[model samples]
Target: MKLLLTSAGIMNKSIHDTLVDMLDKPIGESSALCIPTAMYGHPWVGPGVQAWEFIKGDARNPMVNLGWKSVGVLELTALPSINKDRWVSLVQETDVLLVAGGDPLYLCYWMQQSGLADLLPSLRSVYVGMSAGSMVMAPHIGEYFVGWNPPNDSDETLNLVDFAMFPHVDHEMLPHNTMAHAEKWAADIQGPAYAIDDETAIKVIDGAVEVISEGNWKLFSS
Candidate 1:
């Protein structure tokens, strides 16, 4: 699968160009399925509201400027109550999967329940994971410790990728995600860890992994 996992979506022209190249088609002919289910876990709160607004806006200029013709949201939580086959079809037809950041476990639950996990390996779409969305692709979620909620009881994640990703590290806007926190989080993990800021990301195409950054990031081994 082709994945462009970011702390924040499309931070610069270089990343945008890379994504467009990965798509291998004019963005105008493509469709992006934006998943906002992760943000729902934090309803009414400041961070939640911010994520919800991101979904509502769909990173308007970032996506529009890239030339994606159809950018729409597909709430995975609501799929079980509807026609899943059609939903799956839509997922398959999408050229990109724009996943927003929030609760990693909550996002993983819906993904497994909706059967997206099973289908992800074969998906032709470019997977763009923002923050928690990127975290869910790891073997497990680490000490994300953002808003001081109860720790995720289950550490298991989708395991689509091999390493734990610590996103928003040293992020200017999110003072809560400090380099110190990232260091502590990685120290406790058992495998390779990546601390990525908003301007950086971890991109995996097929079996190859590379840090795609316009700003800064660090990879740690345990």
Candidate 2:
């Protein structure tokens, strides 16, 4: 699967261009499934209006509002109770998966329980993740980002990527997510990591990693 991991959503033209490049098509021609599963697990975010905004593409950052050929909600929490055949083909047919920000661990839990984690390796769609959604692709989110504890009680995530990420670095709204804070988090992570602001995104294709940024980002080697 192609990965376009963003601190925020596709917030700038550079990121937007990269996403289109990854898709190899115009935004209007693509089909997308927006996953709002992570929002419900976050203490500060959802089970309310925020989740609605993201689905409606009226949130602070872009994702679902990109004017795709079609946009559907694929709530991970709902998948376990339903038959896999009902949704598996739908997922396989989609052009992209738009994962929203919230608690990465919580999202990881549902992704596992819903069977999506296992299916990821077979997907042809581009996976576009915002904040925690992007962070969850890493081996670990580190202790600072842990909010909704998983059943295993680990800060570990999907391990889809070799490095961890500290997102929203130095954003005015999230004052605590500074570069210094990211450094501290990286020390505990003890691995390759990135500190990225809203305008930065990491693109991964065939195991190669590239940082595309209009704002600021730093890579800390393990």
Candidate 3:
């Protein structure tokens, strides 16, 4: 499996350029699966609306500059009820699985509840995880204490890959407490932990892990 784990949305031109260059695929050929149910303050609503417009060709969307030809955005607001027939079909047909930014604990819970967490790893598609999407790929979801509610119970994660990732490390653009919250959680987890700063990514292709861009990353093991 090819995994593109990003810290956040392509927040600017340089990052977007890097993504386009790395994937080497047209925007129309790829599909983004937006999981917003985990986000608080209605995070998914804005992106969902914009993604729909971007793919469907409406000027009002934020992603219009991407110029992707065919984009399918699904609003997975809750587990069990979220994964409808349409989302299932999209997952099966899409060339890429783009997991968007949201609350990590919420995303993990919904992912397991919806059964997609198990199914995603098996699909022969490129997996793109942004923000919380990247965090859940880890063995534990506790590292995402910032901008997310803490997890109450220990649950099995996707385990598609071996290492746990912390995206947007030192993301000063966000609220001041984001990194502090994440740092506290990071100190508690035991395993191979990765702290990735914004505008950076880790590309794992066939079990080979490599830093893909300009940023800082740290590996922690206990």
Specify the highest-TM-score model's number.
2
* Better model by lDDT: candidate 1 vs candidate 3: 1
Task: Quantify all predictions' global Cα lDDT against the true fold.
Answer: 0.78, 0.94, 0.61
List the candidates ranked by lDDT, beginning with the highest.
Answer: 2, 1, 3
* Residue-level lDDT tens digits of model 3 in 128-158: 6767777777777553453444365563456
lDDT of 2 by residue, 79-179 (tens): 99999999999999999999999999999999999999999878999999999999999998998988988889999999999999999999998989999
The true-versus-predicted C-alpha distance at residue 91 of model 2, in Å, is: 0.5
For residue 194, model 1's alpha carbon misses the true position, in angstroms, by 0.3
- The estimated TM-scores of all candidates read 0.89, 0.98, 0.73
Q: Which ten residues in a row have the lowest lDDT in candidate 1?
A: 58-67
Q: Per-residue CA lDDT of candidate 1, range 96-166, in tens?
A: 99887777788888888888889899999999888778888999877553332434566778999989988
Residue pairs with colliding backbones in model 2 are none
Candidate numbers sorted by TM-score from highest down: 2, 1, 3
True-structure lDDT of candidate 3: 0.61
| lDDT, residue 215, model 3 | 62
Flag regions of model 1 displaced more than 4 Å: 43-52, 58-65, 146-152
Model 3 misplaced regions, further than 4 Å: 11-24, 41-65, 82-86, 143-152, 174-185
